[model samples]
Each structure stands twice: as structure tokens, then as C-alpha cells.
Target: MEIDEKDERIDKIDQILNDEIDIDVNQEGEEAEFSSLQDKYQINSGEALNSSDIYRIAAKESTRMIVLVGPVASGKTTMETSLYQLFQNSPVNDFCFAGSYSLQGFEQRAFYTRIKSKGNEPTTQRTSLEDNQAFLHIRLWNRNNNVISNLILADISGEAFTNHIGQVDEAKISFPFIERADYVVGIIDGEKLCNKKTRNSIVSEMIEMIRTFWDAELITDGCVLQIVFSKFDLFSKVENHNLILEKIKQQIVARLSELFMDIEYYNVAAMPSTIDEFSVGYGLEDLLQGWVRKHVRKSSRKMEEPFDELTEYDRLYYKFLGELNE
Candidate 1:
């Protein structure tokens, strides 16, 4: 039998794999050893990523960074897990769930809401202050355009924001990601908004937090801000919900309009207490659509930077391939 060019290449590759790589295919438990090697290199996914992991992803392709800002127990984690859970049933908006690097992270937070936990009401696990800076990643495929968007949602603890209230210098140092963020979501607890005593204070504190970021230069006038009122089911229980919501919106606009040119509001009952009355992941479709719209608009005017100085891998992955695709 004559060896063709393709066969010659395959044989050479096999020779390199067996000889140069020194793979003992005939050795006992070779499969087990290969699995061990994979584990040794930490090749598995499903864990929340850190800053270094995010950098690696960004270097490969463009990613949208979304930072959720709020006080503790304000539904930030719930909102994140709810978005992930939404894809479990069907596509969100027009985006389909392609995959996730942090499936374990999402499931861990959503465990309490599952029937296996046997809880009377769905409750989200509060994000710990220690893991406040972790990023939960999801890759969504757009049905209409056949485009893939990599979204990294920062699960920042509410304590992180509250502790740095009025502390601009500290906030600047702590939240460097805010400068690169595509969206900064400020979560307002709807239950607190319904309370007359806490309503004014919550509104004032939220404004002050934004001001601190503005003074620190972490959030610029160009930054897109999403004001999210979570647990709307509880807030809507109040008789004058519309009036109160209007007042809150007016207050936010009056305080933040000068600092943020793009400010959008969303009322979501993520994991609502009254599941029958309100659907799970309520109002999140609009939020997802808004993110896609803003991202498209931003990408149009954004300039591509030179990757000549970057590593060969980064250049190959991002510069060459990314530009060619564009």
C-alpha cells in the first residue's frame, strides 16, 4: 500500500505523540493515569472564576463585565441565579444558553430553591463577603444573529458596597473592575422600598454610593447604570406601589442623571414569594434585551486596540481570529 500525503502527516503526528510525548499506551491503567493528568492540570470547569481567569477569557475574546452593586440580602445573588435558572427551561429573550464555566457556582446558590431542599419558600443563598469578587460566567448564543456573547456577572457582596460608603479612595482601590465594566447594576431591595421608615434612607444611601464611585473616577459619565428594584412582588403588595415607584425613579434620576447619561430601571421579582401570582424570573427578559442592545451600540463605536505587544497566544486568539471574524 502506498502512503498518501495525509497518511504521512497522520503517521508523523502519531509518531510524535507516542515517541516525543512518551505516552505509554500499553502501560497498566493508562486511562486512569490520563484522567489523573487532567485533574492535575485543573482542566475541569464549574467553579466561580477569579480575576486572573477573567483576564484569560478577555484576552481570547470580548467579554461584557457586569457588576451588581447593592447592600446585603438585596437579591443580587438571587438575580444572578435566577438568570441562570431561566435558561434551564428555555431561551431567555432571544439568547440561548450555550454553556457556562460556573455551573457549580450557580447551582450552589440555587440549591435552597430546589424541591430537594424542602423549603416552604424559595430562598437564594446570600453571597458571602469573602467570595464577593468572584465572577460567574455564562456564554449565550443569539438566535437572530448567530453571535455568541460572553457575559461575566460580578457577584459582589452588599457589604462590599456598604462598607465603602463615602469612602471614595477605598472604593477606587477595591473596585478597579468598575472602570472596565460594561454595566453597573445597582440593586434596590423592594421590600425596603415599601417601608416608609427605611425608604428614604435606602434611597439616600444608594445615591451616596454612586457619588462615591463617581468621585473615585471608578464610574464615569459614560458608564451604563441599571437601577434594579428586586422583590417587586413584595413591593407591589403595597397599595400605592406605582406612586412610590415613580417617586423612587425621580429621586434616582435627580441624583444620578448628571453622573450617568444612561440609566435604566427594572423591577424584577426574581424568585418571587408568590410564585403563583408572579412568574419566576419576572422582568428579566427586558433586562437581558437591554444588555444586548447596549452592547451592540457600544461595539459599533468601540475601537480595536493593537495586540502586537501581547503574547503570541493572545495575538493568535484575539487579534488575528477576532479581527478576521469582525
Candidate 2:
């Protein structure tokens, strides 16, 4: 009896939706009829949004696209994996999250080929294939006070940002997908930064690469430049390593500010290997909690400043320049 009632309810809703669509077709020349049908459709749409009505409303209005960018071995993939593990099977009451059923990484080449081949055709797939290594794109849904579905994620290649690609031209490179994102994640290797001898080389390369690839508009919008410092455990060495970390972060922030004054930064910790100990999961709650408070906070379950916001060396150089000017 319960099943029958559920089927009946669905049937009635379908019938109403169908009837309205039909009315819209027939009312083509009649503005009044079109308006009436629109109102009816919107009312029915409201019912589909579920309980945490506001979140659903927000999700629809703003489909969040997470763009993960970083160097070849900066643990971007590891971070993606950890994030997926957190929200994958978690239960939520009302809405279904839109994500790849498989835990996969995005393949950029394949995605570009497919999109370009389509040549303006509409995709039948709810989410396009090769959409960001399967970990960079996500579509989320909210239900009651709980959230459901891990949302889709896509991760692009690190090579794209390694070289001077124009901002507008770079936007075109990602095309339709770039058009979809509301957030971004920039992964950094903290282990590398905390090493004074290697810090300058990597940090400078990352800044140049950012300009060579990535879009400036991406810099402007709800784009949160999450500077996930992977392999954070490597930085726990001694006093000097701590000093190195702070200096490098400030340098990066300064470079970004030079380009566009509005960019935001973040630190992310990821386990680089499947090894025991020196892992990143302990006391991860605080990290996840902080992530939830940000502009692009959502999950299947989980999860800066300058010179004090760039490098101490950069500051010293500036001071040197001041003396020269004097």
C-alpha cells in the first residue's frame, strides 16, 4: 500500500509537470498563458528543492565548480582522494549530490577533445566526461540540515600552468568547464617550501606558471585560491623550517597581490604516501571545520597571510631597494 501511494504521488506530479510543459507549447503566441505556465512550473520546482531549502536554492543559483591547480607532485591527487573518502558514502536525508559514481581523477586531454569535437552540441551526459581528473568538478545537493552526495569533482593537468598563457586565452583553454566553476584550489608542496635552499626555485616557478596559465576572471569571482601545502609533516623539523614556510608563503602572496589584489590563500595538508605514521588525518576535524566556513564549503563529509602576507627575502630585497633610492 505504501509503495502504491508513493507511485501515485509521483504520477500526479509528473502529470502536472507534463501538462504545464504542454501548456507552454500551446501558449507560444500568448504571453499571458506562457506566464501562467511559468508560475506553475516554478511552484513545482520549489517542491523538488527539499528541506534546507535555502542551500538548495543557493546550489541551483550557483553551481560550484572546484578547480584544483598545482605542480606535478604536489599531492593534489592525494588531497582529492582524501576529500572523496570523506563524503563518498555518507547519508543525507533530502537531496542527491551530482558526482561521478566512480572515484576517479580527471583527464584533461580527453575532455578537451570531446568538448571541441562536439562543436556547440548539447551534451546528453549530466556531467561531461574527462571533466577534471574526476576529482575537480562537483555538483552538490542539500537535504534538511544534512548534506548529501559528494558532488562531482574535476582536476586538470599541472602542465597547463607551467608556462605565459594570456588570462583570456587561458580561460578559453578550459572553455565550457571554466565557465562552470565558482571556486578553485591551488596546491603547494609545503615540504619543498620549508626547505630554504629549494624554496625560491619552486615558489618563483609557481608564480610564473600561474600567469602563463589560469584566467584572470577566475581570479576575480568566487574563486578561492586554496594554496594547499601538501606534505605538511615535512615542515615539522626545526626552527629554520618554520621560518622558511612563513617566508615562502609571503612571497607567493605578494606576487599574487601584484597581479590582482583580491586573491585569497589557503593551506592544505595531504598524505603523500600510503605509509603509516606522518599521515594527515589526525585532528582533521578542525581543518574540515575551517573549510566549511569558507566561500566554497561543501562536502560528501570532509574537508594565510602575507609576510606575517610574502618571503622574508623579498622583504629584504625591498629594503635594499629603499636604501638605493635613498
Candidate 3:
């Protein structure tokens, strides 16, 4: 009886969502198709950091695409906002902020967190799942190398990652940028990792996520995988902090060591707690410096080409066939 009731409720919700979508399509035009949903709902659409502009920038210079993956409330937004604010105001190590294509978009995400309430501490609003296509763009100028590089950081809602956690094929479909990403940042909530009850779930989800990436070939041997423990300020206060960190390494990192070649770990306190509002973004600069170094030094993921496997005779045959077809 409970299962039936649950199914009925799901059916009702599905119907309502379909109805709303139909209404939206009808209101727009008959020419509007279901495939256009991204354009209609994606936050990047008609914004400064839209896909078209980012692609154009990529064509001109090599842009390091880093995708952030984590569960809901894993501090993805907070890290992004804090990083943006830091880049805007301060110089990270030696790299100076050259410019950004999406300054206004950065402001939109960072503004709310900067606001302070009289009685209550300000919280960063959850990044909506609807805005999957949006990315925060940061460009840095290296004084030592005299090279300018752009960092395209993708922030998909944590719910998206969790929803497709174990679904390997579905994860490939959902996270299309994984194929082109230079680095994958697996953001885990440090506070949750410290809690005994939640630790298992977090570790399980991360393991599954890594499996999905490996199975889908989105992450290969050479690709860099970064495991970040966010909200470390809270986690550090716990008495069993060392034990929790060891567990994470043993359970999560040790288990997946075979799948990736270069795996790095970092702990970050991205935001200030109510008690230490003045010390905002403690331990975040190190993370940013590491990220920037990767962006500057890491090579792009090499795509496997079929021609590499072809024999000399087969190559000639294909060339002849191509000429005939032409």
C-alpha cells in the first residue's frame, strides 16, 4: 500500500511537470522544441558567460575546463563564490587577474554571500539545478611566464551529480563537459566526512562517482583528479579530525587509486563561520594556487584518434576511398 501511494505521488508530480512544460512551449511558439529547454532555462543563456562566447575564447587560446562534482550542500557554490571574490580583490600567489568575461555573472553568485544581515549570518543561496550550462570564467596573467590562461570552472548543482551518481551511462549524458575537462574537482563536505553517520554515505557516493567516470572513460590515466574537503574549519574543530581524514583517504582515495594517475587532495575552509566572520576564506588561497598552477602547467587531455591504430596499407586504402568519395 505504501509503495502504491509513493508511485501514485510520483506519477502526479510527473504529470504536473509535463503540463507546465507544455504550457511553457505553447506560450513561446510552436517552433520551440523540447531540445530548446536548455536555452530557455539555462542561466548562461543571454548572459556574459554563454556557451558561444566561451567557445570563441577557447578557439583563440587554450582554456582549462575544470568541472566541480559533489553532492548537494557540499560547498560548491561557496567555493566558487569565494574564489571569484578572491581573484577580484587579491593576487593569488604571483598571477594577477588579467580580466574575466563574466564579471556580472560572478557578481550575481558572489553578491548574496557578501551581504550581511543584522541578526543572522548570510548564507549563499543554492545554485539552481536549472542552470547547468552556466560556468564562472576566470582569466589570469602570469608575470613570470608572460602567458595568459583562462580557467572555465563548471558548477553543476550537486543534486545533478548525486542523481546520476551510480548511473554510469546516465552520468556521461548528464555531464557532457567531462569529455573536454582538463581537471575534475571532487568537492566533499568536510563536516559531513567528520560525522560517523554521514561519512559512509559520502564515501559511497564518491566511490560510485569515480567508478562512473572511469567506466565512461571521461577520466583516464593522465587526467588529474582533485579531491577537496570543503568546510575544513568545522571539521578541524572535531576531536577525531585525523581519524576522519585517514578514513576518507583509505575508503575513497585508496579504493580508486588504480583508475587515475595523478590524484591530489586539499582541505579548504572556503567561508567564514559566524564566529570568525573577519577571517573569511581561510585556507582557500592554497587551493586556488594549486588550481591556478594546474591551469597554467597541465596539458590538455589527449583524445584518442582512430588513425593511430591504422596500418600503412589501411591508411592508403582509406585515403583512396576518401578521394573516390570526394
Candidate 4:
């Protein structure tokens, strides 16, 4: 009876989720420009997607963007690299690999952090803010609905986030991308979660970041915020996972619960534990699954109004301000 009840609940949730999200899966792969990159290495067409490229993509009928926001060394790039590797090497349970406009972009970023790299020592270089508008694009074919979804992921600099936390205008000046994001992936270093001092600072920074978003009017009632505790493997070695998690919920979530209409949390390692290489990417699959569900659901629903894009005037104004600073 218990098993039956559990199954029933799962079915109900699936039904509700499907109703809320309109995702149509691709029945068969199409022969198009995207097909050429199936070889992964013989990339004839690919380039780093800049702000204009992403803006053009988003301007299309159904394109969704997921922006990563966190401090440096918070595993934003690691998570991204891991996701691409997973999609490339192996297919997620139900989702099939479609094609990416930025295949070479994914390969370039994912190359350094490849799990099979020499020495097996985790080596992830700090993501340099080369281009503020640049992003890695991943397109997936959702098996559930057979819908093709374009996903835009960004690795914004920690310094950029730090600069704008308490200051709205500063955030506006630095983070024009935030205003156009559909989801904000807030990454917290798991090692910090184990330390009381760092934990306190993390929550404060998170609160301030949210406040900046609120002040800028970047957050809408429908916008989703997903907080990921990265490097969970590190935390497990020193502290009780449940205890630290509960403390974060009590301290961080409790304080900022009212700000977001929808929120979720996950603990991911993104790589194998230092102790052993047996279990790699502990909670990444769950994170990606949740992300897929949210993406598809939002894509299916028609918005009451379209979102505003960053205009030429805004760009010219920022450029002018930069010249004045120089």
C-alpha cells in the first residue's frame, strides 16, 4: 500500500508538471546545420556566442536562458563543464543530445575540466571575464515532450557580482544580463558551508545579491532561483551533511524565502570525491533534471508580455561612462 501511494503521488506530480510546462520533444533528428557537429571534433560551424548572438537567439520564438551567478571558485564553470561532458559522452536517461550552436565553445570550456585529465587531480582554472556577454549554449531534445530547448549558460565573474551586491545602480551598470535571465543559478561553495564564519558570509552575500536584483527590478514573480551547494564532497569529509544543510536552510533560506516565488536547492560535487573515483558527479543528474523540467515548463507557457532586451542606447551609455572613467 505504501509503494502504491508513492507511485500515485509521483504520477500526480508528473501530470501537474506536464500541464504547467509545454515542451515538445523531437521525434527524429533533423538534417540541418546542427547535424554537422555530431562528430564533435569536425566542427565546421561554431563560435563563442556573444550578447548579440544570444539576444538574437532569445528573440526567436522559444529560447530560454539560464544564467549562472556566483563568486569566483564557486564551481560555476565546473558545473557547466560537467553538464556538457555528461551530455556529450553519455545521454541523460530520457533526454537525447540534439545539437549546440556553440559546440566548439562547449568543447573549449569542457576540455580543461575533463574527468579523465592527467593525474586525476581536480584542476579547474578560474573563469576569466573575457566577454561579459559571452555564454555557452546547449540545446537538448527533451524525451518527455520531444521538445528542443536552447539553453544559454553564463559564467559571470565573481568580481562583477561582488561589485553590485548592495548597490543597485552598480549592479545595473555591471550586470545587464541579469535583467534578461529566466533563471539564476546561485552556486555556494560546499567547503564554506562547513565553516561557521564563511557560512554566515555566504548567506549575507546571497541576501545582498537578491536585494540588488530586487532593487533593479530584475526579478519577476515567475522567475526561478536555484541554489546549488557545489563541492559537496568536501563538506561531507569534515561535517555532517544534514546538519550543515539544516543550518543553511535556517539561516539563508529562512531570511530570503519571501523574495522568490519559486526556489530549489541541490548539493553537487561535479567531480568524483578526492577519496575515491568510484562515484562521480553525485547530485548533478538531479540538478540537470530539475533544470530541464523548469526550462520546458516555462517555455510552454506563453508570457503575458515579452521581456525587454538591452538596447543600443544602454550599451552606448555604458561605453561613455567607461570612457569617462578612463
Candidate 5:
């Protein structure tokens, strides 16, 4: 009888062990399902995106590409970061900051300028030519039309273009994205413009950069050219600021009038040295407004159906390309 009881107890223990094994398997199955769901709904990685990444976003949205062209220390990155910083406080030119895929990228660039950095003066980190990603993206919501638009700003290192000053063929090979850009912004350094020594050379270099791009056919007639003077507050401090600005404008117009259909000029002090005198992001609202206005006009046009043979990404790209050409 004792031996029979022992065998019965052993059988009961096996049964409990089997039940625990079943529970463990069920838990693992549930965990696997949760992981699958997480993969399906993964969020943006919050880093600067590459061409493939931007193409993916463009495929699903109405996208506009803005390429900032300038030499080093010309305030290209500053303008971008200032625009992002502006949205943190309030809407800019009626466009609310809807979202950004590159929050970390913008934040990293803007951090040094913030008071938290413990710096004596606000300074922007220079973009390197060797950086893997060149594009930073933001989604803006227009309060007037209740429409959302995607803006992809190319933050390529200024050295990329400055290095290939007269090398049109090399520039063409390197900057293929310029062909697809809706707006090509040429940044003028206001601090350099203020100085008598570097002023003429700075202007000439800018003009030549544009000319090189035009010769390469990278900046076709479809792209709008925006001549932006960055750090305008410093330039304004100089005597005869108005006359200087007019002369510069006349020079640019005389040189580039035939190349582009629309050319606009803006003066922005993204981060002014004299904060008491000039506000941060001075004149940036007008810049934002100009872009939004153009976007609205483009969106109003009728879109033709994309060719069936093209892939989804190609279809979207070509569709926008056609619109810009028109």
C-alpha cells in the first residue's frame, strides 16, 4: 500500500510540472504577439534621415524640398534651427509645428545655442561634409487651409558646394538632389557683408556658386531661387545699410534674372548678438510665409495620375517633378 501511494504522488507531481510548462508556452506566445504589434507600429528613430528615408516619407505626403546652399559659417544651419526653435514657442506664419521625424537632429543642433549650454554666446554647430545624412524634415500644418505639408530641408555641409566652386561636372555628379528641389536658397553671410575686406569676395563667390549650379543644369528654371542674407542685424549696424542692400540686390538681379523665373530676397537675423535691439528669428516669419504661399499655389494645381509602370516612390517623385516643371 505504501509503494502504491508513492507512485500516485509521483504521478501528481508530473501532472503539475506539465501544467506549468503549458502556462509558460502560453505566456511566450502572448509576448511574441505584443512584439509583432510593436514592430508594426514602430515610431520614428528621431535622427537625421538619409535619401531613402526622405523618399519613403515623400511617397506618402505632399513634400517640398528646400536646399540651402552657402559657404561655411554662412548661417544655413542657424536658420534651420531658428525655424525649429520658433515653432517651439508659437506658430510661425500661421503654420503650426505639426511634427518632426528628426527631433533629435534639430535638438542636437539647437542645444549649443540654448542657455542650458553655459556658453558665452549663442553658436550653431557646423555641419560636416562627412555626415551620413543630409536631410532634416518637418511637418507644418496650415491654419488657414487646414492642410498639412512636409518640408525637407537639405542641410548638406557648405563645403560640398564651396569645394566644387568651378567644377560644374563634379557638382552635377555630387548633388543630384538639386534637380528635384523646389526651392534653392542661396545664403549670404551678413557679417562678411558688413566687413569692407570680405564683402565683395563674399558676394562674388555666392554669384559664382549659383552660376555653377545653373551651368550644371542642377538648378533648372523650375526651382525658385531665394537670396537670403543671414545675420542681417549685424549688417544693418553698418552705415549706409540701405544703399549697400540695394546695390547687392541690383547686382544679383542683373546677374541672375534670366536664369530663374522667381527670385526673392530676405534678411534674417536668426540669432542676433544684440538681443535687446533685435529679436531672435528676426524676419524668419516672412520667409516662412513666402514658402507657404508658394506651396499653396503649387497644391492648387491639378495633379496628373502617375504612370502605372513606375514604383510607388518613383510615381510620387515623378508626379511632383512634373508639377514643378509645369
Candidate 6:
């Protein structure tokens, strides 16, 4: 009965999520491009989708603008890299534009990467991201068939988030392509969750920024927010997985629920830096893992581990975020 009920829920989810978002169909190169992709990647049967299928569908039909928002060193870039790969390695083709930039005097940077099936990879060589003057730029097409394209993962520095109130006006400044986003990726720092005062502070600030953005009308789609609790490597090494998941969710439900009328949250951990291999974890019920340790006052801790469970977590995170609209 449990399995049956779960299956029923999944079906309802599928029905609500099968169609692409109601985008501005009139935008130049938008409808024609998506229509071209739909022609090639349309699903025909009731068979459930595999990871590859999810990647393919997202690659072809995803014409949405995405932005990554989180604390400094919260692994936004890593998540972005993995998500790009999750789509790229899938049987479905996805395209990405690596050209990213930043405005001077502003601590933040802007990048434009199109998320679509493999269409064509950018040919030009790009400069390193650390070179404040240079941006990590490339325009890639990862689709061989129909192609769906939209900008991905571009933003300013953590200071853009840190110096919020003092620089709130500058925060409103065009930091990146986020001024009009269809998707907002919020990466949460796990170790921070263990700390009570810090956790609440972190959550409050994020909620405020999001509220500020929404009220300001800078976003094209405030409907979806993909809240990712990244750096699970340190989290599991310190506490029990089940307990951690529940607490994490509760924190999110308490703090972030106000940001959106509908929301989806995911606890994600990337490959442990200690491990030479790559992995991911997803779908754990968030339980408060434990009280913050007396020794670790730092918000983020780098821990070593023998790992398993970290691949496909963040993308599945995206899959569920899409569920919010349902």
C-alpha cells in the first residue's frame, strides 16, 4: 500500500510537470527553438523516465533562466558543474554557454550559460574565473537533435549576499542575469545548519534577500526556488543521516516557507574532496542531526571521508523543485 500510494503521488507529479513552463513564447529565438527541441525529444509511452530520460527532457525542453544563490564557498560552482554534467552525460543532449562576467566595483560576477541539449560546443578559449578582469566564458551546445536553450549559473561574489543591507541598493544593481530568472538555486551550507544562532541568521538573511527580490519585481519567475543543502560530506561525517535530513527540512519549512507560496527543499551532498571519485545523495527526510558541537564554531568545516552516495542528487533536487509548480 505504501508503494502504491507513492506511485500515485509520482503520477500526479508527472501530470503537473510534464509541460514546460508558460514562458514568454514571443521572445525572439525562444518558441521556434523549443518547438524544434520538442519535435525530437517528445515522450510517447507510460514507461517511467530514467536518469538519462530526465537529462534528455531537461536538455531539450528547458528554456528557463537559472540563477545560483548561496553563501560564500557553499559549493555553488561545484553544484553547477555537476548539474551541467548530469544533463550532459545523460542520453539527452544539453548545451551550455560558459561565457560569464562581472561588473567592476561590484563584488559579484555574471555568467551566461545556456541549458539545452547538445547543440554545439563553444569554440573560443576562455580565461580563468579568478582573474577578476577575466570571466569563465564559453557558449556550448550539447544536443545533437532538437535543442532547448536558456542562460544558466551567473552571479556576483558572496559579498553580493554578505553586504546586503549596506549595499542593498547595489545589491539591486545588475549583478548578473538574475534580474530576470525562471529558476533560483539556493545552496545551503550543512555545517551551518548544526549551529542554532548561525542557522537562524543564515535562513533569515536568505529569506529576506529572496523577499526583497520578489517584492522588487526583479525576477521573471519567483514561482520556484531549489534550496540545496550542499557540502553533505561534512554533515554525515558528523551526524546520523536520518536525523540530519529532518532537521534540515524543518529549518527550511520554518524560515523559507514565507518566500514562496509553494516550495520544495532537498538535502544534497557532493563528492567528498577526500575521495578521488565523484558521488551524490538525495531524498532523505531532514531530521535535526544534533546540537552544534562545542569545538566547531566555524560555519563550514572541511572533513575527510570514505564515500558513496553523491551523484544525481542535485539534479534530482532540480526535478523536485519543478514539483513546486504542481
Highest TM-score: which candidate?
Answer: 5
Q: Between prediction 1 and prediction 3, which has the larger lDDT? A: 1
lDDT of each residue in 209-283, candidate 1, tens digit only:
888988898874356889999999999899989998899899999888877657899999998887778899998
Please give the CA lDDT of all the candidate structures. 0.81, 0.48, 0.72, 0.69, 0.85, 0.46
Task: Tell me the spans in candidate 5 whose CA falls farther than 4 Å from its real position.
Answer: 1-40, 295-326
- Show pairs that collide, candidate 3: none
Clashing residue pairs, candidate 5? none
lDDT of candidate 4 at residue 157, scale 0 to 100: 72
lDDT of 6 by residue, 240-311 (tens): 656756776676677656555445566665434444332532322121111000111111112222223324
How would you order the candidates by TM-score, starting with the best? 5, 1, 3, 4, 2, 6
Give RMSD (Å) of candidate 6 vs. truth.
21.0
Query: Once superposed on the true structure, which residue ranges of model 4 sit more than 4 Å away at CA?
Result: 1-45, 115-120, 275-278, 294-326
RMSD of 1: 9.7
Off by over 4 Å in 2: 1-62, 88-144, 147-152, 163-171, 174-176, 212-216, 258-267, 272-326
Off by more than 4 A, model 1: 1-42, 294-326
lDDT of 4: 0.69
Best by lDDT: 5
Task: Give the Cα RMSD of candidate 4.
Answer: 19.4
Q: In the order shown, what is each candidate's alpha-carbon RMSD? A: 9.7, 14.5, 14.4, 19.4, 9.2, 21.0
C-alpha positional error of residue 192 in candidate 6 after TM-score superposition, expressed in Å: 2.8
Candidate 3, residue 283: how far the Cα is off, in Å: 2.9
Q: Taking the tens digit of each residue's C-alpha lDDT, what string does model 3 give over 4-90?
A: 988875675576567643335444442245437645565533333645566877898868877888888898878887887877677
